[model samples]
Target: MVDTVYLIKKPAEFPIADLISDNDVLILIQDAVLRQPSISNWYACKEDVIARGIKIPDNKLLDYEDILNLIEKSNKVVVW
Candidate 1:
């Protein structure tokens, strides 16, 4: 399980590097998928990516169920 899960819903640079650790997870949803960051342990919402016509890699995309599973498995969750 991950220590923390970050749900990014918008496009903005908020110095997340300082808050994130190696075991933490980052999920890009909504408009945030448009700005793909070259960070490890990062995932994008499949539905959002399709809706936005974003071409994220298959391995980097997560369905709603996967997202729920990640949130449930995480120790903490932060939305941005």
Candidate 2:
């Protein structure tokens, strides 16, 4: 199977990074966008991060269009 996008809203809600497989992608939004963890495929919402004044490294931001692309790339997506 292809990778999945684990859409996380709250930082504390996620268990541990070990639970997510290397093929899985962790996408943070809302409050979770600011708190980044050391995950392999980590992506945060561009607009949400900007609204919260969070400075993320280059190429890490995922806009709405980018999100749609990610959804298309993945076999399935799960929101947490």
TM-score per candidate, in order? 0.93, 0.86
Q: Could you tell me how far off, in angstroms, the CA of residue 64 lies in candidate 2 after the best superposition?
A: 0.7
lDDT at position 8, candidate 1: 93
Task: Report the C-alpha lDDT of model 2 over 1-80, residue by residue, as the tens digit.
Answer: 34888888997766477778888888888899868887657888999999999799868889989888888899889888
> 54-74 in candidate 1: lDDT tens per residue?
798999999999999999999
Clashing residue pairs in candidate 2, if any?
A: none
Pairs that collide in candidate 1 are none
Q: Report residue 18 deviation for candidate 1 (angstroms).
A: 2.2
| Residue 14's lDDT in candidate 2 | 68
Q: Scored by CA lDDT, what does every candidate get?
A: 0.89, 0.83
